[model samples]
Target: MPRYSDADLLEEIRRVADVADTDSAPSLQNFRDHSDIADTTVLRRFDSWNAAVVKAGFEPNDPQQRIPTEDLIAELQRLREAVGHAPTIDEMIEQGNHWPSTYKRRFGSWAEALDAAFDDINGEAVFESRAETEPDDPGTPGPHVSGETLLEDLRALADELGEPPRFKEMVEHGDHRARTHTKRYGSWAEALEAAGLDPDARSGGTQQVSTDQLLADLRRLRDELGRVPTATDVVEEGTHGIATYQRRFGSWSDAVEEAFEESDA
Candidate 1:
């Protein structure tokens, strides 16, 4: 096996951390599985797996042992009280007893942590409280989701459904709604267009490339892999990323369907 520098090993650990769920902490197994470097190599380089994980800016392996979950929750409550409202991640990072990641590890997500803290204080659900407190929904819009984030979510949902999403599909299958998209981009079609999709091409074919070219590429990949290419497969092997396909044709499934249609044609 090739020897990796300490910086490379640290970067690999950070990558694992990035992909890990907010409620869970990254483990040695995660690092070993995701990275090209072996666990033994990591141990040898850093003197221990935990040491290597620590160097990557993540909390220690037994974070709950070091800082009790109750204490973490208590600190979250304290921070909320200090701010007189739900504290943002940056505020928690700056003012709380521990890093925001600690809260995430303890509660799956920062929003969940806030909900728990709010519940603890007021004995009411966060959603119910929000509804009661902010009667005017239009005046108090939800958190600002960036265009890039919205696009990323759209592509992820497309990958999951195997096709580009319709307005109703987005409301049903996606985290955000048509109204959210409309608020951000004026219309659902505009959001799709902004995400690199041609809203006019409702047949799941894009004007960017000829159907023949797309079919040829799909057939070529299928021949190479000896199976139908998944979105991940297409991204790694094809000219365009999965998002590109979703944006162009509405979804990866749609793209595949279009390829078949072209083949028949």
Candidate 2:
């Protein structure tokens, strides 16, 4: 028998090893069945199947296993170079078609598939904004207007008006600007604050939720529910199930307390 050379047998073994998944290993029996190499020649090189697999460039249990796709591409590219030929776009397309299936099997969705394919071709995926994102919602307006312009405008308006015009006089005379400010702010105190006045400094008093009142409310809720109220319950009841609760009371304690309050009530 014209026995196959060691180099040819090794190359064939490497090709099979390349296609096998991380969980699989190549065997001498498979080689005998698939290739024209004789068992006698294969036995001469490898003492065992494990030895043959190791020779074909793989550890028995490598955690960081690489996919054979790139290696296969590299081999094909090398062959093309040897024959003075360049792979065409159609050939690349045919090859690229395998990427989605390969990616989906590894990752579980189309988005993940695209991400993996992106990594293979370009080392990283480009960011894709969701279709629902609104283009016109620029954050917080212009810094010039947002931070300083409003204050500047208020200061300018105050300077132009001068000496804090009497709101009672304006209301009696039905001054349009005074009427507009009163309508928007509800009172002179609110209007003064909007124009950047320190009402507390002038009045010298403090306003706060009394601890006794808070305790009374909590006790009432707990008694009604036969349990303590949660933050979520308080927020939901207080805010009428508005999403504002999530913003204010972000802890489990708050939700529990609110829940208890509602239950007790």
- TM-scores of the candidates are 0.28, 0.20
How accurate locally is residue 151 in candidate 2, as Cα lDDT from 0 to 100?
A: 33
Tens digit per residue, CA lDDT, model 1, 1-265? 2224688778878877777643445775565456434444466568665687778876676855667777877887787788676665545533555656667678887677777766544422553465566543432333444557777767787677655566656767776544455435534554566676554344455556555656677888888888877654553345443445655686567989887666668
Provide the overall lDDT of each model, using Cα atoms, as 2-decimal numbers.
0.60, 0.39
1-265 in candidate 2: lDDT tens per residue?
2123456567767766565423466654355445433333454456544566677675543212334555434543543354333322212222222222233344564344334433333212221232123222222111112323333433454455453333433334321333233223323333445567432222222343333434454555567666675532332122111112222355334644565555468
Superposition-based RMSD of candidate 2 using all C-alpha atoms, in angstroms:
28.2
lDDT of candidate model 2 versus the reference: 0.39
User: Candidate 1 at residue 70, lDDT?
Assistant: 77
Worst 10 residues of 2 by lDDT: 135-144
